[model samples]
Target chain A: MTQESAARRFVVAAIALAAAAAALVGLTLLAGASPIDALHALAEGSVGSRAALGETLARATALVLTAIAASLAFRAGVLNIGLEGQFLAGAVAAAAVGPLLSGAPFVARAGLLVASALAGALWVLPAAYLEARRGVPEVLSTILLNLIAAAAVSGLVRGALQDPRGDYPQSRALPDAVRLAPLVSGSRATAAIVAAIALALLVTLVVEATPLGLKLRATGLAPAAARAIGLPGARLRLLAFSASGALAGLAGGLEVLAVTGRLYDPFSAGAGYTGIAAALLGGSHPLAAAASAMLFAALGAGSSAMQRDTGVPGALATIVPGVLVLTVLAARARLTQKRA
Target chain B: MSGFFAIALLLAAPLLLAATGELLLERAGSIQIGLEGTMLIGAFTAFAAARSGAGPHAALLAAACAGLLAGAAFAAFAVAGRADPILVGTAWNLVAAGGTAFSYRLLAGATGSVLEVKALPPFAFGLPAAALAAFFVPAVLEVFLTRTRPGLALVAAGDNPLALEATGGSVVAVRTAASVAAGALGALGGALLVLTVSPTFVEGVTAGRGFLALALVVFARWKPLRLVPGALLVGGATALQYRLQAGGGTGIPYAVFLALPGLLALFALAAARGRGGAPKALGTPAP
Candidate 1:
């Protein structure tokens, strides 16, 4: 996509979002709530306080990582739909490995990150193999795998990994050493936000400056041509898939270290899926993905407040982001046609 | 033996229904990955309608209509509006899930107490209408597709829409109609899910059956006849595990049992190589 078209899409998205917001206000009225109050509550919950701001940043940090992973795979001509499964598996793997590492502090943290990344990559293996060997659609396989992971996560947390002392289906708490220290006291925010931003910068540089990035983009843009010219398209795809998995896994790792202190059922609040939305919203560009992730995170962080202040229910909370994405898609429909 | 067959058919009912419609949609060169979302809508509407005094027959119709509407909304963006099908489908999934859950909250309260209703009883020979429909629909469709002119036209549209357009067929019309019909089938699956196995509706009760149906289509090589065994295979995995869990708490984790069908589908897809039956222009929207 050219810069002009990208900007056009953004403009369309902005208009669509404003329309959606108006519709939401109308919805709040139908539900017998004060729309102005609801908006105020949403604003307050997202960034009104230091703690609220910190939480939003923390959520944004994980979203940015996952979105970057998604955009990377998409740029390489592979739709890595297995990120949900990868994220879940990565979270579980981090929890499993964290307690096992009793060595040096830095080594333990790095070990957690690496183990999560590997677990995520392995989780994506079956989908990758099916596409590579059997021409099976990766989209279907990955989606199925995500369903399996959903069922499996609750089972693992409740059965094998459950803390014996607790009645709930949650893992044992992470030791103090395994947890990432918070950047802001009295809030969930941690230095992972910095890491996420840094990673986005690094990804931007890699995609724009590196030969490897060029090859991946080339493969995505024209797989047939790349193969005709002997670009080892297959290997590049596999590499892209693995890298996507690793990044998704890293998001899960940060979630465990910086947000959740241990493995648990419902490990993520659809963070993996939202990553896809973030990538699309950002035009699949790394830095833009980070920005969009923050936007989504704010929406997410404020949803609860929208419910609490207006009696709107959690459904309205979920509907807003979905409507936003749908509107964006609607707005860009014309631009894509023009490009075609 | 009869009981086992009944259980298999019961589990396969939803998958079979959705796969049938999906075959037609695929034949018309459109893939609606939003079937899961559409199913969720159907499941909720059917349950709500039933709870609000609709008869079982009416409930099923309501579900199917809801599915059709949901599917149409999806196609408006996916087919007409020129959005990427995958993304549109994913967004639809989230919207349906959230919308249904939200609706339940508004109607049932924030507590989300399980809404109970009597299970729709089996008909002749102790089998659900869904199960019977599964058996007969494919047979009827197989004949209709093979013998009918419209079926051939649908196939032509899928293989090469541009050519079909040249031949005076409206590609958009065929795809949009197929998408709507497919949504109805997806809703039927969801309605069957709540009406048969469970006496109450729960969030995400369809689980991943919609996607499993998609996988079945792939495994069947887009052939409706082949989908029977494919549906039965997955349905059996799901049905048998529930029975196993009910019979006794085996030492195995329940999650492993739940995930069995997914693994089964993955391997089945891998083993289904060289079938080569996909419509050539399936995912590519018109320029």
Candidate 2:
């Protein structure tokens, strides 16, 4: 990249950080807390200790997975709003299968997790096929599918999948064999962080080294031109979308077998939406998206610390991402104008 | 019997208003997915104003103003800056969601399940208890969209921006205005929900109705004239769900019922087979 483009990227990042800080301050004032104290608390909570850092990394791992999923679809010109649905579906599937194979070996359980995520991708195939064949906008279809998935999951959890011992809408906990081993003994952080990093590396290698990635990027930039060059545009888009869904599903599966240990209502908690912002901020680069996801994970993990230390409400965390997105969007607009 | 219709009509009012407004915007070639957030802001603003002793009219005006401001802000991104419309719109929704929740906690001290506010009183016409306001509001919007020169210009801008530009009209200005109008109508929809429903503010009060409105725009094929029945269909579906759930039909999942309208809309669109008549440049940014 040129120095000017690099500087512009920095400017955009700075603006996003500034906007997030302002939003935190606004939220603090709204909640009758001192913004300075909240900032300090947030800093101390996220990175002050090794344990806090581990927790942040753990959350970032799942977020990075979702972000990668979003980046893939975005790079193929498909807007997969159904990531949220796919994520939930994958989580539920993993949660369902994890306990069933309590006697299975570790390798088998791992395979089951991957298989469950693939099933989640299958859940979105109908919608993707509809969009590819009928020209139904994926945006609308995916969103509607998300609602259906949410409702479906909610029903299953409330009814048949409900933990027999409890009345709450949650699934039975998975067996120890199915759970992802923790990376650090003292923290909730798991092997998923390492897995995510490896996946990010794999993504970078594929995007930079492979011909398929080239085709995908070409189609994203200009579908008409790509089609003119004899590329299978529709099939490529469908593959990208399915792969995106599978990645999102994998994130969900990891959360189930690694973090949460069971399925529950509001299982993903808008992780899919946050993933979109992460992908945008990352500019669809795997490593950058991973870093952005880590930033968001830090913000989310630190919000609780801010609340406890400075009496700021947790809502500030939610506001920060939105503020970041708007600032990034504005800066991107300015950068594009300069380029033009 | 009329009471059932009244309740259904009351429930349908916000959807009708918002969908009509969105219909106009889509007709002008700007698709706004931020209606949920815009409506939320409007609801909160209307609630705040009413709680602070503003009359119903003042609260409604405040809601419109809030919607206009939010819409204009979005326009600044999508129109002036030429940012991706979907990204900007989603950001607006997130902003509205987080901002409103934070404000709610601050203003209400975070205690109550529902934040109570004064609701707008229904204006009854002299015709045996059919409220005139419902019919009057839609009629007025229809006239504004079809009869006015600027309204026709807005549609033209969406339909053929280059042609409109050749005739000395600015596409951006028309789109921005349409967006603002859509926002106002979306906010009015939220305000009506507060007025007619429970006279209280609740989280997710709009509850994806704004999305349903967008679907209505597609189903109506971007015509104000067609949006009337489109709103009814959606509202009827929603009303049917509530009615079914209330009647204790627990065998079939309520979520399945909830999915019916959207699935049905998708089917209808598919059946139409590109004949549903979308704007020529519905998703593209204008030059």
Candidate 3:
């Protein structure tokens, strides 16, 4: 728990991560791939050019929001893993609202944002209630809610929000006015990236610099202490869940409004899971979470290149963050054990 | 109706297999949330092994071994270092997915042939081997838990680790062993899926059945006898989707069929948690 031990733990985690990557490359070689080609493809895909950078940033935009959302609740000692469900709730809401709004772009965007956040909070309400009153572990209820939300959204898209073309199990496209304008000329990156950055800053400010933030952290660290000091434990926990849900929903809404332009049933695509790693990697610090989200986003971008050039499945890239998270958790545990 | 019953049994086989091991592991106080990943790794390993000309029996063995290894690896983080089970479990899933997809592409590159492996030949009257296991594994587990000392030790690991340790039991050993066995069973479920049903490996093929089994554990309240009803209910709901598709039923969306079990499980959670029953020391690593 000392600074020296923390540093040592960080070094060990970094080493473990490097070893996992090395093992992955070795596995790729066993699969008949050239190590150089795989590495090159990864590099080229993530930061090789302006377009690739744009794509990576766009993906990171969503990841940043979700990771911060995760960090917020986790810092409050709540493992709110229902970000995936909450993400879907937001996306579906945005997709639905996009079609409802008429001429004014500002009104449409504002309405879509509120709708997404409201829907996200609504999605986590049941789990929050259960955890608060029934003593249900948030991990269990949220995961169950994730499956249900996925199925519900899939059903909604297929039945009511089906595109007129009817070729895919997806929602109708948003109008041009409702879409976030591209920040870069040739890439998918949009103004949402700026939104993500602003939100990250705001989150850091709220979580680190505010009295409420102190209360939330105290609630997580010592609920009894917080309660003795007149803080309402259940209410604070519920607020954290609701706020996290809103942020997760905003991430989903941003993806629909900026990147996909339509609601894809599987659009969340494990972002919720990925965001957890990102948050943990950042030590649950908002800015750090955003940075790690970008790191994961690059990994995701590089993976597509790996898939295209090496014929390796893009999912291979997802393994790196997973490995990082596992190593980090293990290293932290070792440190804590040793300290105790 | 008999055909429907038969199909539902087939549907329930993998879930039945996977949940039994998870039940054992949980009984021993470690919640291996990575069962889905374990199954995926099993399915892929079995498929790869079978494609290389291993017999179905050999394939199943390979799958179980893979599952055990995967489970042990997960436990190394979950039980060894006292990490969060959800975090460790999620990592295991990613590793399994990436490893399977990476290997599959390498082996089955461009112009890959549709390699078929031998399916497990059914026993009496086309009842697959898995169907037999599905029918009886619960009973075996039930008897094992109630009639054996080791089983009692496992239960003690879950509810009273300190007491068990005070009486000369090693909580870590019990949990580690239970976790590995659980992984092996989940892998067996994966093997059962490819060998008896699909007879092929697909990326992400377990399709949340492993996750569904987690709910089954909760729904059954950790009782082996109750698991049958829990697994079958989900299977029956899934089977309904197939029946609706085959019947050309109008106005019924497949999504409803898919979400049916999920909704049912959610309600079950609500009902079951009226008392908040689970092993007391579950997920808490022993010193």
DockQ order, best first, reads 1, 3, 2
Number of the top TM-score candidate: 1
Listed in order, the DockQ scores are: 0.63, 0.51, 0.57
Where model 2 places Cα greater than 4 Å from the true spot, the runs are: A1-4, A105-108, B2-4, B55-57, B110-112, B122-142, B272-275
True C-alpha contacts between chains kept, each model in order = 0.63, 0.42, 0.53
TM-score of each: 0.95, 0.93, 0.95
Candidate 1: where is the Cα deviation over 4 Å?
Answer: A1-7, B1-4, B248-253
Candidate 1 global CA lDDT score:
0.81
True contacts kept of 3: 0.53
For residues B53-155, could you state the per-residue lDDT of candidate 1 as single tens digits?
9977788999999878877887788788878788777777777877887777777777757788656777766776665776677777788678998877778
Query: How far does residue A162 in candidate 2 sit from its true spot (Å)?
Result: 1.7
- How far off is residue A111 in model 1, in Å? 1.0
Model 2 lDDT, residue B65, Cα: 95
Residue A284's C-alpha lDDT in candidate 1?
A: 75
Report the Cα lDDT for residue A256, model 1: 88
Which lDDT tens digits does candidate 1 get at residues A1-340? Answer: 2234546866876786796688678667766778888878778888988878887888887799888988888888888877888888889888888877877767888999899899888888888888888888888888988888877887788788887886988888778976888886877788888988899899878876799988888898899998898899999999988988888888888788788878887777788878877877676777777787888888777767778777776566556666767777777876767766
Report the error of model 3 at residue B283, Å. Answer: 0.9
Against the true structure, candidate 3 reaches a TM-score of 0.95
Error of 2 at B280 (Å): 1.9
**Model 3: CA > 4 A from native:** A1-9, B110-116, B248-254
Pick the winner on TM-score between candidates 1 and 2: 1
